[model samples]
Target chain A: MITVINSILTILGIYFGIGLLFGIYFFLAGARKIDPIINDSKWTVRLLLVPGAVATWPFLISKLFKTEKQ
Target chain B: MGLDYQTILWNKHKKVYDKLILAFMLMYLLVFAGLTFTFNAQTTIETLIIRAFGTLAVIMLHIILAIGPISRLNTSFLPLLYNRRHLGVSMFLAAAVHGVFSMIQFHTLGNVNPVYSIFTSNLDYTSLTNFPFQVLGFVALIILFFMAATSHDFWLKNLSPSVWKKLHMMVYVAYALIILHVFLGAFQQETSPFTIGFLSIGFVTIVSLHLIAGFNEVKTDTKKSEKDESNWLYVCRTGEIEEDRAKIFTVDKERVAIFKYEGKLSAIHNVCKHQGGPLGEGKIVDGCITCPWHGYQYLPGNGQSPPPFTEKVATYELKLVKDKIYLNPEAFPEGTEVKPVNC
Candidate 1:
């Protein structure tokens, strides 16, 4: 039972770590380009969105790096 | 934009959308319940409602997600996008019914709180086959609750559209969790090939639709242009853009909409201030560029909303040489009064 609980804790830690990284990237860079509406959002509001930002990073990444054709 | 908010800001179109949703949900519940009761008379009512609403919620979610890409790929499907929030809220209601009933039936009457049992009773985290599926559903439900709670324009305004949109994008996370919930819970208990096949087909259909729409957008974004000068790029001929409409061009990674209205031409950032909707897709309504997504209007020249509204988009300089439209790749600060050129 202890082993099962430890395994769950480890998995959750890794999951949240990845989510936090993506969330930080979204806050620093992707938010402005992906959606201009969020450009002036408060820091607290931005922090609240970390979990969602992490979850939807795949779609947001495509939009973020999408550049204009010269 | 109104001061007071109703339970639902019902209009003729919203009424129609709600009627269709109700009719579909009722039809689905009746058919599913009827079939279950007929096939297995011994199945309890709680189980029947759980299955019926669970399936309906998932189906509505697929429809909700599909509507975005479908509308983007084909403008004819825009009506579906207009009242999509109602569909999302309705889906959450259905899922809530399923979740509540399932909790009452399975998790209640145990030694602990019903909600507590949902997480604690299922402790087989290491084993994929016997994983805690209810935990997945619980997490998904919490996400859906937040999404549904903030589905109104009031929240969009208060939270700012960017934060609201990002928060709602958690629907994809909820979707993944729901998929895992069904696969691990029901699929394990019920080995019916029909159920498995149905879920697989729905998943494949959603993935394929998104891919097709994404590829189409990529084609638009990657369109090549001929540069005429250092900061100015050639857009298209004057005749190319229809009166009261726009010809959107991507220059230096920024989208610009060149509009022709009343024998005058203007260029502005393609992205709308509201919800990042594509302003180019909108037409001139009463001499202002009206966003198709929500009818948020902005003057084409200065890219500022009319009096009493403060929304704005960046404007660009436009010049006509030999009937060809040339736009400056550099954008002016938003709401700069760049006068429209006579065409």
Candidate 2:
């Protein structure tokens, strides 16, 4: 049981680590494109949203690449 | 959209909504507690509190989720949409109470940290009957906490409406986690058919309401129209639009709302700048297009918020050919001053 719990914890840690990295990238690169309303926000406010950003990155990615109709 | 924020900018409507919510919560707790004490006097107080709050929170969440689709299907239900954030925050508080009492009751007095024991003490992941349901509840609680903490215009302004909206969409994820938590946890121990039936009904109701609302929207969007000379889409006869009301059109997959007010016609992007609400669905209030969702307003001519505010939306050029409204598919840059054509 101890070994199984440890393995689960290890997998969770790695998953969140990767999510955090993607969150950092989203904050730096894709936030403005996905949402122009954040243009005037402070860096600290942006940083606070990192966890949520990581969790919802798939939706952001779609918005980032969405082409506006002519 | 106010220049400054209060804890809550309470109005008569909000005050009444909040009072109703509180009354319902108190009544639910009272009845639940009374029934438990009468039927099973052996049950502890902590267990009673946990079950009562947990069930109430889930019930409130169902109501919150239902309000959106119900309002879409019938506009009279829009009153419920006004103070929905308050409902969300209240639900979170109830869930927090359930979580705290649960943690103290089950995981405390152990050799390890209560928070740490929550994850490590229940390691039966391979078995469906014992799959550490507490962890699922914990994850759902974390998501709810984030949502409730940021359920303010301050976060809306700082995080941007789109990102804030995306973040709040995690409610669906939390809902799924909670469903799993209840199904695998209490259902395993209780094995009562009534409880399982109730949960199944709630699940089906939410899913069906969403599907029905989505189908209605698709039907509206797919309505056919015509085109005119110079390739501009023919929206509708000017007479089709009522005074101070808008006729929404989908031009090349983008929604445009053409409003007729004060003997003039103007077209603007249908999505509101504040929360992507349907501008066309709203009526012209005080000579400005008011968003039905939150009362965000914009002048129809320039698609800009009236002076002292800076929000803007894209505008489209319109032509009047003998009372027929022809709209150019191209959108001008947001905040551009477009001349309104006299009807």
Candidate 3:
């Protein structure tokens, strides 16, 4: 059970990380401009980072180290 | 100038959070019924307290998320604008419980170092699947701690609005971190689709509201920018303004208030420096422009907020362009001499 949980956590971490990266890209690319309209795209895209980083945790654990129980 | 959005949302959301905190206490009663039956007497206390705090966190998250939209729908909600710090601090106090109790329940004692186990236990910061939810929580909590500590009006009085606004914007960063923490740390373990869907819906609703508000602001500002003319020419005679009352004029999206005191005419931004209350209608008290709402006093010549509150507003260049009394829309530093409109 511990091994299975750990594997899942590893996947969540990686998947969320990808989302976080994408959110960051959107934030950086759109946040600053003379025209404030550009910032909206950044904030909308940035919201994705929260759920993405969160969902990837289980997968992240599996890749980081060998699960002792596995 | 008017009350900018940062203050507006801050105000309305505060009332929402106030009502939210009160409502949260009622939920505390329902949970107690379950705790009494399921757990042993001692474990009941621990479990109830810990879980109750988690529920409080969830409640706070919902309130914080909801505040952005409720405030946008109304204008009278502006007074809540001044008390935003209290709301934020209250939210932090609620979140603190989850922060401390989680440590004691899951990570304290045993063979493992509490701090080390936080990063190591089932979380891999480097791995995509388990990239360390606890660390994000840790970082989020630290930022919350800083924000709560500095939420005092004392800080607002001392720090420039630009500096203070920049620091407060970190709440968005903290929110993102907390979002990840919950996803990996809690929902991952529970595996409840209902729970996951609820949280996702909550997040999406909030982001959509903020985006809509942002767009609304863009549209409003664009309209204002277009309507306000390049120059405002006034036909004021030399002694048109009086000492007790201010003559209000609009130029290039700026509200200019001309105050005549002791034979000199000084032009200042009509918006109050403290809360953006209209200064034109405000009474001149003790030789200063006092905001009617909060009594924020500013020296008219310099537009500087008086002692104990460091605030300022833009001062316009006053020029008598012709007998027609032409006023330049361009503003100058406070206390500097500019040509005046004799309209």
Candidate 4:
């Protein structure tokens, strides 16, 4: 039981860890493309996006590429 | 209506609202602690903190849930709805504190990770009373944390309003989990009539308010409209709609708001671009139909936001004949400029 729980936790950890790295990159570069207003938005506003970005990085990645294609 | 986004677009009203929230939270915590210590002198500081925050979060969750229905029932409660995200975040913060402190106090001495221990610390999955309620709470906290993280308009825009709304609706799931957690964990051990009664009352109140408000909304949506030979729906007379206000009706299963403003009548989609707020519930402010929930405004004529703001809603054609209003059920595309009919 512990092993199964640990496995789930590890997978979640890895997912969110990758998400964290992607979040940083997205905030620094890609966020502006998706939301042009972000270019002029305050750092605090940008900072507020971090947790959401991390949680939904896969969606963000797809959006980034979609925007790039556009 | 903002050209740029800040961390929070603070106004005097929001400041006052937040200050009131802070004062209320502090007073509640102090009172809870004082009462707990007076009644149970043997209670540890950790237990007091855990119980205090846990109960506070539960109360906050009940209030948060109630606000939606209350606002739906009465527009006067709409101001509370505007800053509701702050209350949600505050509730999540309180829940997180209770969860973390409880985990550390109960599970930190184990060999396994504390989070992992939440599931493994109690093996009794079959028993009703011995169920690992902490696990339910941990899961609820995760849901609340996710919701709190994505509560900003940034997520609403990026994820799309529909998707964001769906994701946030997981609050119902968290609410269920927390209810089970309290019943199985705290109530099982403490067995205090007061605590049990409080939880029962909160749960019943939230549920009853939602049902009442939901029935009222359904009554509006299910209203039948008379139709002309051309299939234009017959709405109420122009006089029925108050000046600068709207009379909402169901047009082809979609809600449409017909506003009477400055001797002209115009119709637009009732749902706001932001948060799906009911535009009909909001009065025309500054010559624009403002959303009651978030103040998202749209031009009465074009169903488009005023200059520098790009949000828009679908417009419907309206005809005013001898003070009788008729509406074409077919909607033009969002941002379509339909001419308003003079009343």
Candidate 5:
């Protein structure tokens, strides 16, 4: 039971660690590119997006790249 | 509106609403603390903190759940619905506090990691009475955290309203977990009549409100309007609709809002682009159909948001034959301008 719990936590920790790194870049640059309205948005709005970005980084990453390809 | 972004589109009303929330929370905590200290002198400060915040969070969750169906039943309650996300986030914050304090006080004493300890501390999952209630709470807190984190419009736009709505619906799951957590953990520890009665009342109230609102909506959905000679579905007489307001109809299994404004009638999707709010319950404010939930505006004629705002809803064609209004059941593309029928 302990081993399974530790494994699940370790995987979650790693997943979120990668998400954090990706989230920083997405908020700083990728967000504006994906949504033009975000270009002139306030710093507070960008800050507000950080946690959501970190939580859902894989989806945002796909969206970011898709917008770039276009 | 997806035109611009701010941390919060703070208005004077929102500011007042937030201030009221803070005041109520403080008042609740103070009263709870006073009662606890007077009655339960033997209880330690940590237990008091955990119990107080836990009960407060449960109360807040009940209020949050009730707001949706209550607003549906009475448009007068729309103002409460407008700032409901703030209430949700605040509930999550209170729940997180309870969760964190519980972890530190109970689990941190052991050598194992606090989060890990939550799951393994009680392995008697088969026993209903001896079930690990803290695990239920911890899972519920994670769901609440995800919800609170994505509560902003930024997430709404990015995730798409449908996806975001689905994600937010996890609140029901969280609510269930919380009810179990309180029942099995807190009630088991101290079974006071007042606590049990209060919890029962809160649970029944939320469930009843939702069921009533849902049944009323199902009536609308099941109402059949047969097509006339030209295949135009029969709608209510022009007199049935009030100026600046809409009468919703279920057409082709989709809800449509037909609005009477400026002596002309227009039809659009009943669902708001922002948050799936019922646009049919909204009024025409400043000549735009304003959503009752968040005040997202759409021009009644074109089903489009005014310039700089990009949100839109599907429009339907309305035909007036004398005093009886009829609608073409087919819908035009979103933001399509179907000339309003003069009544």
Candidate 6:
């Protein structure tokens, strides 16, 4: 369990670090002219989908995992 | 924009930005805390749900970080610079969560503790692909935490601006390390070629934008210095300054705005302390140099504030040599150190 977990974390650590670096460079490069038009556009909408999906994912996955009597 | 209109927009937009970050932080904590209680019932499906939320928080932080230098290089972006520490704190919280949750989900439940296993289980850290990437996250989080902790106006007021700025630059170094960490660990683990392409584009786009902006800021500073024209003595005759009026003179390549009013001559730095607006184009309002651009009022005699503000600009020593104005370019203490100049 520890090995699997450590392996997963190792991946995530890099994933997040890369995102941060990407964002930093993005900002620095566009500091002169970029207005972040796309980024600022209603991120809340994307965030809201999380709770909705969280509520539904378990329900959908549970049914598939259930055994049926023949 | 008019002062009142700018004021309204400034306040409204500031409120929206602040609330967005704060509300996001609150939601992250609430949902992540819920996961802790529901840990016993957790599954891969649940972990994926948390990951989705984590991704959302991370993107918002990127946006928040992007807003700073973007606004600094452009005056229009001043709204973002105003009280930006709140945004920093929010980013810290989001990054901290990313660190903690990954630790719990992947490492903590194992036979040995996650922290121990991370260093021990990981193969050759010396190798590029099999690096202990979580340590990078830990270090980055700590840097973010320090920045967030010092993100108050109190620190800005206490520490010199130069010192504060240098400390904040550490964020860039941390960010770079994080990117490398992810490139080696996360993308490697997922083994998704598509993710690699997407991450490369993201990195490229952001870096290019910043490089361009940084270069632009450097150019702006150079241009300002080169544009200055100065003369030994600019003879704008004795009555050049009328009561409540300002006259601009170039002395030793410095723009000196001399104001004459009520049989008195007052000379001050011709540039507004706020954003270096031209004070020569300004007016004397109630004994203060009222900047035309931003309306930042400065007293000509000593450059002190009317009250509740301490911003000041350079002042010059003036002398009427041969009935013509002979000015010394040496600047006196800005604001409230009144030295009499015989004019």
Error of 2 at B325 (Å): 2.0
Using lDDT as the measure, name the better of candidate 2 and candidate 5.
Answer: 5
Task: List ranges where model 2 is wrong by over 4 Å.
Answer: A1-70
Q: How well is candidate 1 docked (DockQ)?
A: 0.04
Clashing pairs in 4: none
Q: Residue-wise lDDT of candidate 3 within B180-291, one digit each (tens)?
A: 7777756556676765676788788888878887886555434432111545556265556567557767665457787666555667888775545677766678788777
Q: Rate residue A1 of model 2 by lDDT.
A: 72
* Share of true Cα-Cα contacts across chains kept by each model: 0.00, 0.05, 0.00, 0.76, 0.65, 0.00
TM-score of chain B of each: 0.96, 0.96, 0.68, 0.96, 0.94, 0.63
The TM-score measured for candidate 6 stands at 0.55
**Number of the top DockQ candidate:** 4
Writing each residue's lDDT as its tens digit, candidate 5 over B1-343 gives 4467888767898899889988988899889999989988888989889988999999999999999899889978889988898889899999999999999998999898898889888877788998999999998998898899888887888888888889899999999999999888866677778777888888899999999999998887888887999898998999999999999889977899999999999999999998888899889999999998777999999899998788889999989888998999889999999999999
Q: Is the docking of candidate 6 incorrect, acceptable, medium or high quality?
A: incorrect
TM-score of 1: 0.82
- Per-residue lDDT tens digits for candidate 6, residues B47-157, read 654454455544554565566557645757665655465576666766766677787777887798676665666656677676777667766776776566445332333
Residues B215-310, candidate 4: write the lDDT tens digits. 987887787889988999999998799999999899766899999999899999999988899899999999999988778999999999987788
Give TM per candidate: 0.82, 0.83, 0.59, 0.95, 0.93, 0.55
Task: Pick the winner on DockQ between candidates 5 and 6.
Answer: 5
Comparing 2 with 4 on TM-score, the higher-scoring candidate is 4
DockQ metric for all predictions: 0.04, 0.09, 0.02, 0.72, 0.67, 0.02
The chain A TM-scores for the candidates, taken one by one, are 0.59, 0.62, 0.41, 0.83, 0.83, 0.41
lDDT of 2 by residue, B138-253 (tens): 98998997798677665576557988898899999999998888887767668878777878899999999999999988887777668776889898889999999999899776
> Local distance difference test, per candidate?
0.83, 0.84, 0.59, 0.88, 0.88, 0.59
- Candidate 1 lDDT tens digits, B132-212: 998899889978977876675645665568877888899999999998898887766887887777788989989899999
| lDDT, model 5 | 0.88
Best by TM-score: 4
Q: Tell me each candidate's i-RMS in Å.
A: 8.6, 5.8, 13.6, 1.5, 1.5, 15.6
